[model samples]
Target: MDSARPTPGLHEALAYLDSLRAGDLAPQADVPEDDEDASYDTLDALVDQQDAKPTLRPSPDEALTAIAIMRLCHAAESAGPDLLCPRPGLLSLLFVSSHEDRNRVARRHPDLWRRLSLPFPALMIEDPLGRVGAAKDFHARLAGRLLSGNGVLAIVSGMAQLPPELETLVTARATLPPITRRMLALILEYLHPGHDVDLPISENQLGKLAPVALAPVLAAETLDTALTQLRRLEDVARSPNGGPGLDDVYGQPEAVDALRQVVSDLDAWRAGTLPWREVTKSFLLTGPPGTGKTMLAEALARSAGITLVKTSYSDVQKAGHQGDALKALNAAAEQAKTGSPSVFFIDEIDSFYNRNQSSNGYILGMVNGLLTLIDALSATEGVVLVAATNDRARVDPAIVRPGRFDRHIRVGRPIRSGITAMLSAAVADVIPGPDLDRVSEQLVGLSGAEVTALLREARTAARKAGRDLALEDLQAAADRVQPQLGDALMRRIALHEAAHVVAGHAVGLPAATLARISPRGGEVVRPHLNAMTARDIKGMIAAVLAGREAEDIFFGDVTSGAGAGSNSDLAQATSLGIRAECAFAFGPSLSWISPDTPPTLLPTEVRNRVEARLQAGQEEARKIIVQHRGAVERIAAALLEHRELDGAALAGLLDGVEVQADGAVQHVGGHDA
Candidate 1:
């Protein structure tokens, strides 16, 4: 082995080399063995995150040997005190930032006590449960030690979890420096002379195994085989506890397809067949909650076979002050970079609202820090950063430009098939009694989160009633999540959705993008028509009110659904009309009025002009609806049968209809899909 890279502990390595030349490097300090707390039962009893059976941890003796090997390798470097080792004036109030089992402090070996000059029986408390138990016996034990003038080391996952009663007694807080590759390489060389120690593992991977376990991993017949074993160990330690991969996710095929392509690209890049810049590395998952935005990040990481460091801006701020928060934020960035071929996900990015509200230093620091990290990670080759927000409009513009998040993927509520799959999975263990396809149609308006919650409600009832979950329990829960609308309303929604598609196409829309309806409600993704021309404005206005016009023409009256919310058909039509008149100067009046201005405050003349445009659009929509009655009926029938008609399917169903946006007829089936 080339001895050029001596690592940080050169003194220790040289002494060991001299001992090889002379004799043995006798173990320093006759440190007594203290393996009482290292017992298997104690480690088992500490905490079980999963309700299921816990995985087997290293044996007490195995852990001690690993620790001893690590100390010997980095003898001089690790001689200083850490959180778990306290002597007199040092090692007070050390905060461990990670909740991973590998990052948590293990039972201290005998040499650790001698090195730190600590008591023979050291006492340390790490509250993985945080402050919830602060008022319990924990506070009593900590306070007693402080009052007695005895040394104590208290560790917490976060500073906020530290009760105010003992805040004054705190000296400092920090996270332990993890084991690094340099140390491991030297350990390998020391274990087997002339052995190649230039391994590919990173510091983050080595941090998982306790010091004592390295002998077994490095002692494999060959270094290649040893590496293979270490990879399996790292995978187990870093797994998101068996999270679902891209294939396991049921819906959002567009997002899934995009992620799968990136996964392929990642494989190609690693194989030297694709350029790193061509890879789509950054993403923004924007949509309603319970739509599995975070789950998508998890799936992407699992599908790509990489690590995922999930965090949020709030998570960083929880570290304490602005300085510490920035440190924590930087640490997350470093972890992502070091753990290359990694996915770094930050949730609730909308909270970084535009920097105009930078009233305090903390908010500014966080936003600036995040932007810096995003910029740095975007330039990185194998790292992918995925950010999620329930409210996309609330996010700042600068943070979401083309260079930052290359794709803005929308994760809407699952379609009928996705809902059916979810329902089937929830009750897979129970007796299968219900036709979930029909039930999924009725529950189409519910979000994935709502479906999970309702199922949980059903499980509770089944457990209370002392019987397997039955069709009645599921139906009862489904009703609570989304009440079943009768057949009459269901047909009406189908017609409402179908009319938008038919009218939009008749008015020369690029195409009907999406048409979906449930028994309770429905939605249609309006054709994306900008105000590039007055004709475009007129087309959008007509399509917006087509649903209302269809209802009025068929039923001789209109339901309040059209005018229900700010995003309703009537509201959208009014908005387009206002923009046409005031913003676009396409209407009779050239007067400009802010859309945010309430209708009551608008000038009488401007309001009249806007009202006139709306009336004309509604009349045009009525004409188109009447002309496309056959097209509307055919599509509506399909929606009732399938609960959804989107993309090429909806387009193919409208192939026979011929209309033009210029008020002229055309036979082309061209679309912007």
Candidate 2:
């Protein structure tokens, strides 16, 4: 046998064209037929009968097509035996990137192309000019090979620009994903049969090279050295160039610590020292907006010496059509999985719904697709998945369930210590003994993004004035971002927040994480009540309404702080009451309303029960406030003087407010006395 490879069949196709010109080509109806060459009416018939695996000795174009099949089908070859590749004619489209890539897969239907192991085919659109032409007879010849009976694979590079008549043949369409590091390794290994070849370079580095880059690897004297140099250059390019890492992240000690452990595990894994399953590669971050979920992911990626690819459900859905959006989502998932030592940061992940018959089919498809992608991603060795959502309740349970996301980390607003550290870092030039303790207290409840925004404005102010950023400038900037409330209003805000702390504690709720007064309103960020029983639900409602009750008791009135917005105290209390009556069967009827039903749409009986529940909660809050009046006053005064309270100090303050289950004013053991 000659060692030379066979023509990619395009040449044979041309020869057949030449045969046609010389009047030697037989008509299709008159051609000889056999089981191997007989036309199958359906692709299923071909798939069911043919079990031919791809040829062991595949040309570069065939290898490229294999990678294309994997991408288009979203199938990873690393997934073992049972993972079947699609049959030949089922691969309707084959997308490739550039002219060189186009040349590799175009005009050539190799034996391997005839048996594609992919469910979906890729579609890459380009103008194939002279290589393919608009000649009247040439059209007939090209279509003959493409639409042939015995399965011809159409590798689409210039399929889009094909004459309308030819383009119509493509019933479905798709775009090609980039050549991943794993794909590159496969191509090299396929080329050098029996050799263990692994590229030490990242997908970013691999993507910079076309399929043609393999020529050098196949020709190189030392395979390892070439790969080492390529990786070394990229490592240098990716060096710590003053970018933020986990060390730079301030506040949220638990989140930082958890991420640091993950980074350590990833490092050990990369060093080939850690067991595969020992790494917890995925975690869900739940917190209010701007708590730095994305920032933490970025820092974690930097610490791990990997790239961070940030995307969201909202971003993927921007592709318009459900099919296109799903394609975009698949592409994003493949991008991260292929690029190992990477963090796939998906924000607003809750936007993708859990499977519900009531929801549109599009959402169900997206949710199903996301779950599959996440499963593949979580199982992949080097990928660290960081998914964030503000409302954890809205997230599909399956997506956030243990294995899919290893754990949940609540990235709350920074406390006093975290705030101090953030302020100190922001003005590094300031003397260590400066008043950051006070500065931190003043900005305690603000989100990290809000703080960063104020700091940026301060720096900009200094820059515009041609001066260094002073402590005064920082304070001035904070004032500008949120103008300080009047003394009376400040006191009221402090009282409002302190009441929430005291009421929650009195009702035996968990310790509040933070309590602060801001210009917009006051906040007492408590651990979720996780209220289970009817009484627990009612107690939580009391705590929700305590701010209003405190205002009513102390100032003989209430502010809009507890009522104005949809997220206000009144809204929450009402919601809890509605849930108790309408959904949870905690009230009158055993029947329930549909999920996500608005309160206004509720029946008068249910609405009345909800109102009655609210009234009872108000009475409960009033009793707590009246009993702890002195402690409430003192804590409020302290909050006004200090601007915020948390940790040991806040715990001490709340601990002194003694609780008597029967509504009696009890004495403090040692503190309040």
Candidate 3:
């Protein structure tokens, strides 16, 4: 073969040889040809002889033959049966050696002399372009050969972008061999300009890839799936063609309205009617647990006809390498992008924000990356990002600020109407006469999730007994599932809650629901009466402190529900009280100074102040509970008998009680008279 004008086929063979050089078993320098050797001279003469054969107007079969020959020779040279190329027909024996060995042999002997060492002469072609042209022509012929049942051909391409020629080749008139068309659609969503693509993988795929990928990707995939499931549920929530509005949710008009606003914005954006900048694109659904924060997010995705991507914080954190995790996340986003107009949901976003001080700074970087991704997606078309968190207080405030997350909607527990709706819907099928009114009354302070669970329990009982569900079943279920606050606790809680009610009512704070206790954690539906002014909060603290002081005077020691270790309740009351005195100016001692103007309290100081106020409140709570011992017993007895009572029931029991001027009751440890 002419070195300067090696055939295109030869070049391909050489390139293949060069690739092997980088690996083991690379060929040594070409062995020098012996001019005196008659076999070598004869082979050289034959090679030069073929070069003059009018180039044989190369046919497609000839081209394929050349490629096949090159492949065989290359493989043989790399490793061997030590066989020389006797002729084109003998190339079949070359398969006995590995392809690498064949390539090595061809590299060592690039001329016809190597062939003369065999039994026969093999034709040689000199032109380079002719060789490429021949290769292309050979491929085309191979397409025909494949159609003629000589072999099989497989074409892989993006979804809906299959090559026309290949398609035609497969569908040709000739009897084609079994050919498989594999569609490998890869959708890359550009969440940010420089950010990697976010490929949304299904839950099943997620399970497969997460083990190999980084933590962030796993987190993103998990969140995406959860959100997607929620979205589907939301779609099922509505009547056909926007028929009737959803009636399952009740009482929280504010929450409902906020959700509606988000949905409206999402719809407008989807319809291409809203300005990109003005789109209510992102939201931070924050509130007490069991609220429909997660549900609402799903509902929004469903209504908008989008796939939801749910991610977990723990999964993201567990990703060993930051880059790996990021890549996984990007892949998921990209996957979601394939199905445009998708929702990317990240649950427990606080995990990323509240990285431990010991975390080797990876979390902070991840958070920044997430922020960038979210911001980018917000600006991009056809994608929505929704992050849900219960502990908004712990979330990095920067994330919830203007650009990252513009909408901060508090997803609080269901109100009376909401409870009624939730109960009615939950028990609609099982309860013969579903008294939502009664159920709602009994379910005071219960969350959406709790109500759902209650219904599920009732249904389970009915199924176990082999009977249809009845109100009795629900009531029985309710009996077994005690509220977070029991009778004993409620009596104490009643006095405690009563103090807040009376104090707030007395101080002209908004007249709202009286204190009612439940067994479930986070039962206080609306913890705050209103946005507390500095003065109002101060007065409330004084009342709490005074109640504690009164409790100490009347009962001697603090009660379980009223004193220390009541983390949730105490935290609430103390935090409020402290803020009132120190931050809100509700206390006389700290009213002169603007708490806002001062630097925020150190954690230690805040804890100290909270503890101090809690102690004071404990003393007052003891006195108040003791002074109203009769009323307390009445409420407690009622609670024990009924298992639960609404604010109205407790108030009715206290109707005959006389109040002292100091917001105290007259009776002590006696039955109501």
Which candidate's lDDT is highest? 1
Cα lDDT computed for each candidate against the true fold: 0.66, 0.64, 0.46
Stretches of candidate 2 off by over 4 Å are: 1-242, 354-358, 430-433, 529-531, 656-673
lDDT of 3 by residue, 18-119 (tens): 333334222232324652111112332233323323321222222222333454444344434333332222211121111222232233333322322343
TM-scores, all models, native as reference: 0.63, 0.65, 0.49
**lDDT score of model 3?**
0.46
lDDT per residue (tens digit) for residues 279-345 in model 2 = 8888889888899988999888777766677788899899887777866776676566434557899
Top candidate on TM-score is: 2
Worst lDDT 10-window in candidate 2: 664-673
lDDT of candidate 1 over 505-603, digit per residue (tens): 777766655678875578875324322477766777888888889888788898999999887888988887777777678866666665557777878
lDDT of 3 at 13: 33
**Stretches > 4 Å off in candidate 3:** 1-252, 335-338, 355-360, 429-434, 483-492, 501-516, 519-558, 563-566, 572-673
Lowest summed lDDT window (length 10), candidate 1? 664-673
Show the colliding residue pairs in model 2: 86-117, 86-118, 95-122
Sort the candidates on TM-score, descending order: 2, 1, 3
On a 0 to 100 scale, what is the lDDT of residue 575 in model 1? 82
